[model samples]
Target chain A: MAVNDAGAKQVATYWEGMVNSGLADTKAYGTTDFYNGLGSGKYVTYLAAGWGPGYLASVAKTTSGKWRAAPLPQWTAGGNVQGDWGGSSFAVTDQAKNPEVATKVAMDIYGAKNTDAWKIGIDEAYLFPTATPVLESDAFLKKKYDFFGGQTVNDIFVPAYKTISPFSWSPFNSYNFNQLTTGINGAIEKKTSWTAALDTAQANISQYATQQGFKVQ
Target chain B: MTQVETRSATAPAVAGPAPRFKRGREAATGWLFVLPFVILLVAFLLLPMAYAFKLSLYRSTLIEGEHFALFENYTQAFKDPLVRQGVVRVVLFGLVQTPVMIGIALLAALLIDHATSRFSRFFRLAAFVPYAVPVVIGTLMWGFLYSQDTGPLSSILHVDFLSSNVVLASLGNVVTWQWAGYNMIVLYAALQGLPREVYESARIDGAGPSQIAWRIKTPMISSAIILATLFTILGTLQFFTEPLILQPLNPGSITQHYTPNVYAFNQAFSFQQYNYSAAISFLLGAVVFVGSYIFLFATRKRSAL
Candidate 1:
């Protein structure tokens, strides 16, 4: 995504088009209240995390048994691709009285070992485990999501994860996100060319990154 | 030495600056009385301000830890268009909202001060009710009211108050509603302090209520008005809580950079760019100081005229 061959201007132009054509509304998902509208079938499509199915079923019960999982679309049709929305990880602090035990406990919840059990335990909590072995396990594969029209969503997600290009998370991720979102909103509101908006955002983010002691390319 | 000490003690129980021990006890008592407030002010206000100033001079990051950046962060603030835009936005807000709010407050005060004014108590309480509402709750309430999908106001009036085109004005309206009464009270108190004989003399001279309000009463309370305006300007520059609460519900229009305070907050807390955040805050404080000076100067010139 960072090295998009179409160039940054084109990416912005495409986003502007999406906004203009009503393909996407940047304002829609600014908050979790969007789920209320989504549950009532106000939107046809949305980017979802692993727990999205369970969430949709519980919150947007009206759409239950109608939803299904599918591979995220590639930038170019049939191009090898994957993208992630959001995920979380766990860490142990130095202040922990028993670092070894703390590490073990954190791993038991988040690690690949016994992922099937972890997944089942957090079913109501609505989490998708990131364990490869458990994802491919028979128990995990056999379980059905009636809300997602009885599809094995994990199978699709597990394969999708393999195709995703490895990317590094920057220490300045929040600033970057702010710049992009703010720029996009301003552009949308003013009905200006997205290229200008994106260019401004890029310049600001790069400058800020440099000012914050990050190595800027 | 013992004989000299005994003679000195015998000669002066009430002499020699009340004895060193007595002086020390008195000083200790005074310090003890002021200790709590001094500690609180230093801990909560003075120390944090000093820390922020210190942080403003450095650039801290995960890769480099903390490094001396000197005025580089402040320089970046100067160059940043978002910071510039945010300042301009708030200045405009102050320009519009301050006068409008003061005007409404002044009018309400004058009306309430009039002998013929009806429902004075009711009007006074009604005007103040919004001011009593907590800013976050008030903003959130207004957010719901401004909602295009569910808010009754949008459906009834057929207008989206949260739309980018009118959102600033909508915020001005909210601010005016919240502050007009408070300022009204200030002006009202000033008005009450005026000599009754002045109004009587004005009445004798055939000056009508409106004429007296405009010609006599207003000029008399000019100082209070200026004070209120200064407060309003200061308040507007530091605008944060209201817009922040409304931002989540009114996305695309309300960004993290919507206000200078918000921008600084996002930089420090969200981006972990504490140095840059500190720089932004100091710069904002500088702006406020300059703005207040300009305002005071203008008011002084007007009074001279």
Candidate 2:
């Protein structure tokens, strides 16, 4: 099951592996939908990503099986490249009452010393913490799990955190990004040249930036 | 008898030549009645416009502060290619989207008015439901539907509707979807207001529905159609929300200056070029006013014929 296909391969590989392992009879007890199957009690162990962790945790609790949390699977074992599937941040408004206290609490929860606690809290709250210290700490790093064939999940996060960069947000970021992506995706779906679409997008973005008085490089 | 009549007139006029002061009091009452509206106009509309005009005359950054530059901001705005592009995009949107929207609205109104279809109320309401939805929400929904992976339409059709080459058309589809029904309702009301006797007479004279529609109904409601077209033109010129929402899903296709309003927004907020943004806005307003006047003039000419 190649990840590149992004369709049927993972499911096909799972079923084939189950049959080879004398677990064919167990298939009837589980739904083929992987997302739904994760909730079913048929599987004793499951590997999951950082997204929707809270709902996953609840599902794990409901199933009559033991479950554990781990970092995302790398395309290759110990790969340096990592991607963020989803995450959010918290910021205090200027007009908020007790902003100083709010900032203190935020820093304490998301700051350096309590990295392990933060990770644990995020898992409990069904969120992924963005703090690098928490992601690389001993509590997260030393964990060995049987679900992913005993691969160390913490290794993936350390590399992912190092490779990650902060996203630049602007009022027009959403607007510019949408138009550019829409054009690219449209071209991709239409089986047209993706480069041409991207080129045009670049031109458009530059034109727009210049018009808005942004000194584009 | 003459003496009695003179006395009666004199008695009635005893309060007579009711003071010249009373006329002045009536004039004051008139002013009192209009005072609230006058005060509001000055406070809200006139004050803001004056402030905006003042802002346009200065080179300013929101955070860094402003300095008077006379026409420097306007000059820079005019010189900027991106501003030119924004202006062009808005003009193109108006030219393309306005007629198409109004045409569809007129067609729908005519069909609903003449067709013997059942459940017309249901259709009318369904057509108008898009107007009930907020533009931001509607655009976001359309954005999702335009998504490559999860959108129902994309999945079913197996086409990338948001692609760069086709995005302008895609945007047009969204704007038209939201506005066409609204325009239709306006035109439909106008159609309803047409005297039934005219239609009956035409029918008695053996006139076909198409002839009646083309020759009589359309001509009579030409004013409504023209009004709808003008409204659509103004709305198209100010289009911001749909493109803004769609930009996120596909950044490569849209840019900060895709439309004039967006261009101005980015100028003031993103680039901290408040003066330039102000100038552009004023210029845009002027363009809209002139364009509307031209359209109205043409409409009047047609109506006169």
Give the chain A TM-score for each candidate.
0.84, 0.54
Fraction of the true interface contacts (Cα pairs closer than 8 Å across chains) found in each model:
0.50, 0.08
Compose the digit string of candidate 2's lDDT tens values, residues B253-299: 56667888888887777656667788998988888899888889877
Candidate 2 docking band = incorrect
**Per-residue lDDT of candidate 2, residues A80-149 (tens digit):** 5445445577677899799999989978767767656676665456445566666666755665544334
Span of 10 residues, lowest total lDDT, candidate 2 chain B: B4-13
Top DockQ model: 1
**C-alpha displacement of A58 in model 2, angstroms?**
12
Which is the leading candidate under lDDT?
1
lDDT of 2 at B188: 95
Top candidate when judged by TM-score against the true structure: 1
Give the runs in model 1 whose Cα sits over 4 Å from its true position.
Answer: A1-4, A7-14, A30-36, A75-80, A94-97, A108-120, A132-134, A137-140, A149-152, A199-201, A208-217, B1-33, B115-118, B297-305
Report the error of model 1 at residue B185, Å. Answer: 2.1
Question: Model 1: per-residue lDDT, tens digit, A1-217?
Answer: 2322356667678778888998886555544446656766777776776666666778788888777888776678888666677876567999999999999987877777855566664565556655666656666666687788888887777677677787887666776787777777777777887777777777877776775566778
